[model samples]
Target: MTPFTSRIYLLRHGEIVEQDVLAGGTDLLLSDVGFSQLSQACKYLTDVELVQSSTLKRCSEFATQFSHNHQIPLLLTDDIREFNFGDWDGRKYDELWELTHSPSIGDFWQSPWLVTPPCGENMADFYQRVFLWWQRLLMNIVNNHTHKQLVITHAGVIKQLLGIICELPKESNQQNMFAVGYGKFVCVEIYIDNMGKAWPKIVF
Candidate 1:
């Protein structure tokens, strides 16, 4: 394969009012504060030719609005949805703590690969899914010579994407890994070397 360069802007969704609840996989809309957060984030974006987002309502809503206003191509898919909390979806943090009588969920947050919500997608599988989609996106960027692509996704997906690009090992703790605050964005530059190996660098 020929060498190529691609720049990706990874963005996390804005703040949600129900911060104390585990809303993964839930189809909640963005709150007014969240919209304000997104508005502030828009000031920092530049040269975004294409945008992709998780089809979940919170992400897709903003993505739709942005693409329409900026005249950028948009792609929404489930490939980047937040980690599935399954039965834990929509549950409150304090209530779960009282019921479990321990901070097992917090432990899961620290080392997701070792603990999973009941009936939820395990970290390993989630990693594979996100990595696979990333590979596809890389191919598209290299083939089409696309520059400045934006991805609006959940924090978990963003972290895993960074882990894959950084080539982190399986045992690495994802919860303690990369974190992006609400409505914030991180930029990375990916370059394919002479040997067709991909290298990534954080670019502000």
Candidate 2:
């Protein structure tokens, strides 16, 4: 079946005030270095008619600048915010690991479905919310007049979306596989076929 296609830029937030932390749902603002990285991304962005960002400051701060500068529309939503790390949120990796040795970080990554973080978000729930948001995105854009969109979110969100687009297994380590750096953007070309199935491809 024939399909209509559009592009969406998925961007990860830049460096934050608290460095070397888990940083999920921490609500930390961008560091100087982080803001610079986003400035570079801004120069690269073109033909983007709309901007959407996580409610978190690191993402919303830059998105606000981009939208205002380019006079494009902007939407802030919690659906695309980083997965909440719960008790481990905003803690240093080494410190948190040493502090709470019950659930090994290594084990969690290897088998997230089995090893749940201490009061942290389980992998399954994170996956559900992200994919559901994606479905809604496709539904919203499928029938509307053409508009290019940009999404500013966290590393986890970007990685999950990549896994979905590439059809990768849930057991794989998306963090290492995708390895999206701060301020980098992945251009995903999305097509909704006549049957309303969505197909996505990363355009780098």
Give the Cα lDDT of each candidate.
0.82, 0.85
Deviating ranges (above 4 Å) for candidate 1: 1-4, 101-107, 194-197
lDDT of 2 by residue, 1-204 (tens): 457888888989888999889998889999999999998887867888778899999999999988999999999999899988777888899887686476877677678778777888888888888888888787777767345798999989999888888878866755447788999989898877888776778895
The superposed Cα distance between candidate 2 and the true structure at residue 29, in angstroms, equals 0.6
Give lDDT for model 2.
Answer: 0.85
Collision pairs in model 1: none
Candidates in order, TM-scores: namely: 0.89, 0.90
Give the Cα-based TM-score of candidate 1 against the true structure: 0.89
lDDT of the structure predicted as candidate 1: 0.82
Candidate 1 residue 72 C-alpha distance from true site, Å: 0.9
- Per-residue accuracy of model 1 over 12-116 as CA lDDT, tens digit each: 889876778888898888888987888788776878889999999888998999999989999999999998987778889887665562336766777778887
The number of the candidate with the highest TM-score is: 2
Worst 10 residues of 2 by lDDT: 169-178
